[model samples]
Target: MAAGTRSRTGASAAEVATRIREAIFAGELVPNQRLVEADLAEAYGASRGHVRTALGELTVEGLVERIQNRGARVRSVPLEEALEIVEVRAAVEALCAARAAERVTDEQAERLRGIGRRMEDAVREGDQAAYAQGNKDLHGAVIGLADQRTAAATIDRLRAQAVRFQYRLSARPGRSQTSLPEHLAIIEAVCARDPEAAARAMREHLASVARAIAESARD
Candidate 1:
C-alpha cells in the first residue's frame, strides 16, 4: 500500500513538472519569477510536496534555480548563454534536417509544404501569431521526421532554455519577412529529399538567428 501511494505521488510529481515546464515554455512563467510552493500547489491541484518535487526536477533541467534563502525561481538564461545554445542548436538541428530529408515520406513532405503555405499566408496577412505557430510546426515536423529520439530530446531542452530569445526575435520588425524565405527553403529542401540542401538550409537559418542574437546584444 505504501509503495503504491509512493508511485502515485511520483506520477503526480512528474505530471506537475510537465505542467510547469509547459507553463514556462508558454511564457506564463517568466524568467526570475518566483515559484511559490503554496501557490504552485494550489494552482496545479497538487500537494506542496509534489510541487517541491516538480521544482526539483525542473531545476535539474536548467529551468529553475534555488536561491540561498528565497526558495526557487525561473532561471534567467543570459544572452551570451542563449547565443551559445543557438550555436549548439545549429549543429544538432542541421543533422536532424538532413536525416529528415533522407527519411521523409510523401505525406510528411506534403505536410511540411502545408506548414510553409501557412507561414507564407501568415506573413502576407501580418499575423505574427500564426506565423509563429507555423514556425514551431515546421521545426517540430522536421524533428519528428528525423526519428532520432536523443537528438529530439536535446533540441527540446535547448529550445526550452532559449525560448525567450526566440520570442524576442519573432517580435522583431521585419523578422518574419526575413525568416519566411529561410523557412521555405528548409521545407523545399526536405520535401525535395535533398539531404545536403536540407542540412545547408538549416545551418543557414540558424546562422541567421545567431546573427540576430548577436545584433540584439550589440543594440
Candidate 2:
C-alpha cells in the first residue's frame, strides 16, 4: 500500500511538471514570472506537494529558479549567458549535423525535408508558435540523424535554457521569415549528404540567430 501511494505521487508530479513545461514553451508562462504553489496547485488541480515536486524538477531543467523568500519563478538567462549558450549549441549541433549527413537514412532525409516544408508553411501563415515548434523538431531531426543519445540530451537541456530568447526572437519583426531560408540551407546540405556543408550550414544558422538577438538588443 505504501509503495503504491508513492508511485501515484510520483506520476502526479511528473504530469504536473509536463503541463508546466508546456505552458513555458507555449509562452503562457513568460520568463521571470513568479510561480506561486497555491495558484499552480489550484490551476493544475494538483496537491501543493505535487506542485512543489514539479517546480523542483523544472528547476533542475533550468526552466525555474527558487529564491530565498521568493518561492519560484521562471528562469531568465542573462544576455551574456544566452550568447554563450548559443555558441555552445552551434558547435554541438554543427557536429551533429555533420555526423548525421554521413549516416542519415533516406527516410530521415525525407523527414528533414518535410519538417523544413512545414516550417515554410508556418512562416507563410505567420504562425509563430507552430513555426517555433517546427524549429524545435527540425533541430531534433538533425540531432536524431546523428544517433548520439548523450549529445541529444545535452542539446535538449541547453534548448530549454535558451528557448525564452528564441520565443522573444520569434516575436521580432521579420525574424522567422529570414530564419526560414537558413533552415533550408541546412536541409539542403543534409539532403545532399554533404557533411562539411551540413556543419557549415548549422553553424551559419546559429550565428544568424545570435546576430538577430544581438541586433534586437541594440534596438
Candidate 3:
C-alpha cells in the first residue's frame, strides 16, 4: 500500500496496520525486509508517528521485527515455525468446520458454494489471480460461518506466514490439484449438517496442506 494513501478520513492506526500487514503478506515486502519510516510515512500520507504506531502493532503481532539500534523489518519464519502454525490451523479450522455444520444457514451455504464455483473456474482456467481471490473467499466464508472473530484473526496471521514461504519458493508448482476437491468435501459436509464428517474432512484438508508445505520447504 502506498504509505501515503492520499487522505482517507477514516484513516486510523488500526487501518494503517492492516494495510501494511497485507502488503507484507502479499509479498510486497519480503522476509527480513527493512521498512523505511520516512518513505512509509510519505507513501501512507501520514505522520511518522502514525506509521510508527502501525509498525509497533504489526511487530507485536509477529508480522515484523524491531531491533535495538537497528530498524524494523519483516520477520523470517523458520520451517519448524511454519509447520507448527499449520498444525494449529488444522485443529482450529476443524472446530470451525464442525461448528459451522451445526449452525450454518442456507444463505451461508450458498455463499460458500459460490466461492467453490469460482475456485473451480480458476482451477480450470489456470488463472492465478482468480485462484488467489477464490481461496481467500472459501476460507473466509468457512470462518464466517463459525462467527469466531478470534479464530478468523489468528488464521489471517498464520496465512501471512504461509504466504512468506510461498514467496520464498517462487514459480514452485501450484498447490495440489486435490486441495480444491478437499475444500469442497469439507464444505459439502458442513452443508449436510454432518458435524463429525465436516471435522474429519477439515482435518484431512489441513493435513494435506501441512504435507505440501513441508515438501516445498525441504526443496
Candidate 4:
C-alpha cells in the first residue's frame, strides 16, 4: 500500500511538471514569473509535496530556478545565454541536415517540403502559433530522418528551452514571413541531396534566427 501511494505521488508529480513545462512553452507562463508552491498545488490539484517534486524536475531541465531565499520562478534565459544555446543547436541541426540529405528517401523529402508549405500558410494567415508548431515539426522531421536517437534527444532538450524564444520571435512583425524562405532553402538543399549545402543552409537559418531573437529581446 505504501509503495502504491508512492508510485501514485511520483506519477502525479511528473504529470504536473509536464503541464507546467507545456504552459511555459506556450507562453502562458512567462519567464521569471514567480512559481508559488501553494498556487501551483491548488492549480494542479496536487499536494504541496507533489508540486515541490515537479518544481525540482523542472529546475533540473533549466526551465525553473530556485534562489536561496526566493522559492522558485521560471528561468529567464538571458539573451546571451540563449544565443549560445542557439549556436549549439545550429551545429547539432547542421549535422542532422547533412545526414538526412544523405539518407532521406523521396517520401521523407516530400514531407519536409510539406512542412515548408504549412509554414508559409501560417505566415500568410498571421498564425504565429501554427508557425511555431510548424517550425518544431520541420526540425523534428529532419532529426527523425537523420536517425540519430542520442543526438536527437540532446537537440530536444535544447529545443525545450529554445521554443519560448522561437514563439516570441514568431510574433515579431514580418519575422515569420522572412523565415519562410530560409526554411525553403533548407528543404531545397536537403531534397537535392546536397549534404554540404544542406548543412550550410541549416546553420545559416539558425544563425539568422538567433540574431532575430536577440534583436527582439532588445526591443
Ten residues in sequence with the least summed lDDT for candidate 4: 1-10
What is the lDDT for 184 in model 3? Answer: 87
Report lDDT (CA) for all predictions.
Answer: 0.90, 0.87, 0.80, 0.86
Pairs with steric clashes in candidate 4: none
**Prediction 2 TM-score vs. true:** 0.85
Q: Which 10-residue window of candidate 1 scores lowest in summed lDDT?
A: 1-10
lDDT of 3 by residue, 123-162 (tens): 8898867876776777777788888888888888887876
Candidate 1's C-alpha runs over 4 A off are 1-11
Q: Which stretches in model 2 have alpha-carbon errors above 4 Å? A: 1-11, 121-130
Candidate 2, residues 1-219, lDDT tens digits: the string is: 221133433347777888898888677898899999999988887778888888998999888999999899999898888888899999999999999899988998899999999999999999988898898898988898899898897887787777778777988989888999999999999989999999999999999999988887788
Instruction: Note the clash tally of each candidate.
Output: 0, 0, 6, 0
Query: Comparing candidate 1 with candidate 4, which one achieves the higher TM-score?
Result: 1
Instruction: Give the winner by TM-score.
Output: 1
TM-score of each: 0.94, 0.85, 0.88, 0.86
Q: Global lDDT for candidate 2?
A: 0.87
Instruction: Arrange candidates, best TM-score first.
Output: 1, 3, 4, 2
Candidate 1 on 97-169: residue-level lDDT in tens?
Answer: 9999999999999999999999999999999999999999999999999999999999988999888888888
Model 4: CA > 4 A from native: 1-11, 125-127
Report the CA-based lDDT of candidate 1 relative to the real structure. 0.90
Better of 2 and 3 by lDDT: 2
